[model samples]
Target: MKVGLIGFGKTGRAVASVLLESKKVNLQWVLRKSTTLEHRSVPEFLGVHSDEPGLIYSISEFSADELFEKHPVDVIIDFSSADGVDYYAEAATKRGITVISAISAYPDNKLKLLSEIAEKIPVLHSPNITLGINFLMIAAKILKNIAPYTDIEIIEEHFKSKPEVSGTAKKIAQALDLPDESIKTIRAGGIIGVHEIIFGFPYQVVRLRHESISREAFGNGIIFALENLVGKDNGLYTMEDLLLPYFHLNETEQMFIEKNTKPWWRFW
Candidate 1:
């Protein structure tokens, strides 16, 4: 797959590093709001060795239409601000490019715009795009479904600089139908990110925790999205949608079940 990236912040740089090292996709270019690294090679900037022409461009210098027309890509992974969608969404949709938005949050209006654009091409918006986090959410939902009365608590920890509650924490709370106040936040030294869901049962306590050690985790999530989102129908999607299919039993599990089961007559 040919991929383009939007945003060049710290997280974006980390994601680019992961993408540049991957063999599954070719990173065509990266678009950022600033011109500080304009026309620089992403690989050279990241000090990696690659020949994919991973260039960087400033939005001020190149319009989205011009960029897409001059350099086409199969998918566009966005790590930019929520408003960054306004810049490339239209052009990308016109070209039928899949959009994978890892933006942490989006206003209602922008979300509506994304829905409209989804009618033309696949659009995936994930507030927390880390694979482990999304898996944690799915597992939490499943546990909630199985044990509806279990007392659940969500705890999110991040770097000391982030004061507000995590958007991902809020998402998990919403998924489990817990009150916002049920979320606990811990701000400490340089903790990349941690979200833990505690399920309080009568006999035991179940904890599902996902910790992001580095921003490159987002790139891994993007790669997972790319592998699944191809050939998907035009629609708005989330990380959950991409992950739910893997929830089924694998071949080994299926074989184990088959081997362990006996006919009802054999029970006699």
Candidate 2:
């Protein structure tokens, strides 16, 4: 598969490196705003030593009608901002390229755009792209069902510079059907990310947690999405649907998915 990557941040860099190592993927286009002193050249940015000067251009370098005309891609993997998700989704949808997005949280209106794009092409969106974190969510959901009325709270710790509760924790809240205010966030140290859910009952307490040792987990999740995305028809997909095979789901968990899932646009 040919891939055009968006973003060049920590996860984006990780994804680029993994794509270079993949036997099935051709790591092609990467968007750069500028080649000025502020931005590294393609070779330096992607950690490659290519001599070609024609490579690496920002989204502005190509018009929408000319995006695929000059260079083609089978899928677009995005590890950028929410704006990047909408930007690439529009271009990819026009050219029938599958998109796997691991971008940050987006507003409902932007997400609605994603849902519309999914109507014509496969659009896999995940706020938490780490498989372990997603599995943690699945387990947490099961626990939520087992103790439906139990007092539960989630605590997420991230780098002190990070301003909001990490998306993974919010994703956990979604699984547990808890309100946004139910999450407690700790911004301290240089901690990559740590998510733990505490469930308190009159008789006992239960806790489930997952931590990020490295961003390789995110890259692996992206590849997992790529491997499965090809055979799927046009629609939006999430890690919950992607990783269910590895974990055993009880009747309660299965019913929860059936009940909570609906036409995503319907929420708007």
Candidate 3:
């Protein structure tokens, strides 16, 4: 499998390290721009940086039209910023390449547009790419069935640098069918990430939580997504699709993803 990566930051670097060490995936062009892969280690290319040596791909720029011609790949993984969302979706759809995106904090409309793009290609986007958190989302749906009337809410905290409410919180809320989620966000000093869900009823309360001690939490999920992306049909997939064997979701979360169908014309 040939793979292309964007975003050489923490999670991106870790995932790249694993893929490189695996010796199975061919690292294709590592594009800085979501668009054009036109140069070869040209140095002036905007966002390409490799602290790790012996990478298989050249650091370069890539346009949507030139992607397959330059760096042909079965899959493209993005841990990039929200700005790369549409460009990745557009580029991948053009060549029928599957994209696993862990990019977050974009507006809902952008996500809706990505869903439309998925009708054209296989696109799986997750805000928190930790299998644990994704399982929590499925768990949230289950707990809702057990305590259907409980008042459930999410509280998430990250480092002071983290700008917005976590995408995981929103995922939890969406899993439980809450359009307006009650999610608390706290940004403190150097904290990695902590997420908790509180379900309160007449008798007692249930608290389910997951904490991230390192970026490996994120890497684990990304690698899992990449591994399962092969031989998948074209559609918008979520972590639930990836977690079917290990964790079986019985209700909303299961029926939701499994039954989702988008119109072919919606891709336009």
Best by TM-score: 1
User: lDDT by residue for model 1 over 244-263, one digit each (tens)?
Assistant: 98888999999999999998
Each prediction's TM-score against the native? 0.94, 0.83, 0.75
Q: Is candidate 1 or candidate 2 better by TM-score?
A: 1
Model 3 residue 75 lDDT score: 79
Clashing pairs in 3: 35-62, 35-63, 36-61, 36-62, 36-63, 37-61, 37-62, 37-63
Model 3 over residues 1-109: C-alpha lDDT tens digits?
7777776666665666565555456565555642333344322232334332223332343455566676578877877777776666666777888888888666877
* Tens-digit per-residue lDDT, 1-268, candidate 2: 7787777777777767777666677776677555442334555666665542214567666764476667788888877677776556666788899988887688998889899999999989998888788888888888878878889999999999998667777777877888879999998888888999999999999988889887767878888888877888899999888787667788999999989899889989
Ranked by TM-score, top first: 1, 2, 3
The window of 10 residues in a row where model 3 has the poorest summed lDDT is 50-59
The alpha-carbon root-mean-square deviation between model 2 and the true structure, to one decimal in Å, is 9.2
Best by lDDT: 1
Worst 10 residues of 2 by lDDT: 34-43
Clashing pairs in 2: none
Cα TM-score of candidate 1: 0.94
